[model samples]
Target: MIFDYLIYVFLGIGLFFNVLAGVGLLRFPDVYTRLHAGTKCTTFGSIFLIGSVILIGLKLWWEKDTNGSVLALHSALALVAILLTNPVGAHAIARAAHRSGVKPVRAIADHLAESPPLQTGEKTDKKQQPQEEGGK
Candidate 1:
């Protein structure tokens, strides 16, 4: 009785957040903001979605269904993967955007402006070139 209600609650929350994420991706001004919205909302939504499955699996396992254990285990594993990777992937995308000179729209503070790019090739700037040895 209450279990079904709980599942409904989880599903509702998950669907809400996932839909919110879609809106954020479309509505956010810059790559950083969009990535933040997309990653955080989707990650949180996936947790609720997978959590509902875990609950279902536990309910089935209580009824002596072997497949329920597998379902719960697989859902748990997927949850862990999503938790570990989503933020990291978002950060990577944001960094790539920043490195490629994408500026945030209407941003008041630019904290990363002082930080150097994480990876670079040989510098072509004349000032960056070293002086010749022995004035050669």
Candidate 2:
């Protein structure tokens, strides 16, 4: 049936993107780049894969199957969950990595360094200032 062919095509496309994500994870030089590739590719692949499931569910439901309705609903919920969480999780991971002192390759300016979070006023010695006007 045409629907079956459609499912196969979706699955194939999903598989391709998923594989690309894996390759990107391995090939990218830095954490941010890897996170970008991994998150975007996996999210896109999951959309197609879940879409195929939804289509199958709809087909079955059209044939008056109760289980198909459940499958479709659950697949839709899962897709929503993936859409919401994937990017957020990736962003959290990248932020954590940066905070932990991992610098991006060839990055010139770190904006986070310019504006720090509000701090309670506590006097601390400025370490980076020159101790003497000339070399002691």
Candidate 3:
């Protein structure tokens, strides 16, 4: 009975975070903020949801059920995958978005632009180039 209640609580928390992520994605003004909300919220939500499954699996395994062991193992593996991939994927997307010229809203300082690494054959916009003293 207690285990069931715990499972319900975990599920509820997970659902709440997931819903919050959706809301953030929809309500945020810029891509960076949206990505922040979406990625962090979803990752946190998935943790709770998967945790509930792990608990269920443990309970079953304690009862000497083989399926319970399998379920627990698989759930753990899934959690690991999510933990490893979510932030990295979000980072990649954010970097790509920045590289493609999407600027954050109301940003005061752009660190990436200030110290960009050298890349051979990179084209600079005409406006970025220095004009000759005599207007060559």
Candidate 4:
């Protein structure tokens, strides 16, 4: 009885965070915030979702179901993958966006603004801008 209730609680919490992630993606003002919300919320949500699954598998295994071991193992592996990949992927996306000159909407403080630019082979001519696509 208590175990089942624990699963239900985990399910509810997971669902809430996942829904919040979707809302954040749709409603956030800028790329950084959107990515932050999506990655963080989903990671947290997935932890609980998979945790409940693992609990279910353990419950079944306790009842002598062989498949429960497989289920539990797979869920644990997936949870590990999600934990490892989500943040790294989000960071890559944000870094690419920043490098491509995507500025935050109405940002007050930019920490990256002070960081030294990446070193390229050719010197960056600050005074010279890239030619416009339709330049005569």
Candidate 5:
């Protein structure tokens, strides 16, 4: 009885986090922030959700039922799917956002933007001037 109650508690907690993730997605402003919130929170929440399912599956399997074993195996596969895809999806979103120029709010520094200017004509020497070396 106590063990069953514990399983229910895990389930409830998992559901709560998933719900919180949804709320974060709806409430956050701008694309970057929204993506950040959506990706991280949802990933975290999903762990709990899947963990709860896994626990239930484990409990079932412990009871020596055939269906429980199948359920547990499938739940593990689902967890793997979630783990592999979440980070990759988040990376894709972040890359797309960056390429689209959706800058983060109040960003003071841009390291990539500060790269040295590119020379159009040719490669310049370290100690000599380009104008003296190549006459245009």
Candidate 6:
């Protein structure tokens, strides 16, 4: 009784935030803002979604026997997987976007302007060549 109501509540919250994330992705004006909303909102919503499943699994396990235990354990593993992957993937995407030169819109200042790109490459242009050539 109470468990079912809690599961429904979790699902509702998850769905609401997921929708908010979608709206933020579409409505945000800049890459950084969009990324912020997309990552945090989706992660929050996903936690709730997975939490609902976990509750459902626990309910089944409480009510039933061995098979329910498997379901509950697998859901727990899935929740762990989501927790491990989401932030790492979000960091990778943000770094990739920054490295690939996607600047934020209407940004007044950039603190990372002095920071060098993560992966260095060989200087391919003569402008970047060493100033060691003798005068003619």
Judging by lDDT against the true structure, name the best candidate: 3
**Candidate 1 clash total?**
0
Worst 10 residues of 1 by lDDT: 114-123
**Residue-wise lDDT of candidate 2 within 6-118, one digit each (tens)?**
99999999999999999999999999999988999999999999999999999999999999999999999999999999989998898789857788999988766422322
By TM-score, the candidates rank as 4, 3, 1, 2, 6, 5
lDDT of 4 at 102: 85
Question: What's model 5's lDDT at 90?
Answer: 86
- The residue ranges of model 1 lying beyond 4 angstroms of the native Cα positions read 114-136
RMSD of each: 7.0, 9.1, 7.9, 7.3, 9.0, 7.5
C-alpha lDDT of residue 25 in model 4: 97
Q: How many pairs collide in each candidate, listed in order? A: 0, 0, 0, 0, 0, 0
Q: How would you encode candidate 3's per-residue C-alpha lDDT over 1-136 as one tens digit per residue?
A: 8889999999999999999999999999999999999999999999999999999999999999989989999999999999999999999999889878788989887777623433322356444423321343
Estimate every model's Cα lDDT from 0 to 1: 0.85, 0.87, 0.88, 0.87, 0.72, 0.78
What number of backbone clashes does candidate 6 have, counting pairs of residues 3 or more apart or in separate chains?
A: 0
lDDT of 6 by residue, 1-136 (tens): 8878999999999999999999999999987788888988988998899889877777777887667678778877887887898889888898778757788887677666522542133234444323322321
Better candidate by lDDT, 3 or 6: 3
Query: In candidate 5, what are the lDDT values of residues 31-125, reduced to their tens digit?
Result: 77777777777777777777777777788788887787788788779878888999899888886777466777787765543124433322444
lDDT of 1 by residue, 36-112 (tens): 88999999999999999999999999999999989999999999999999888888888778857788998777687
User: In candidate 6, how many Å is residue 43 off?
Assistant: 1.4
Question: For model 4, how does the per-residue alpha-carbon lDDT over 9-74 read when each residue is reduced to its tens digit?
Answer: 999999999999999999999999999889999999999999999999999999999899899999
Q: In candidate 3, how many Å is residue 27 off? A: 0.4
What clash pairs does model 1 have? none
Each prediction's TM-score versus the true structure:
0.82, 0.80, 0.83, 0.83, 0.74, 0.78
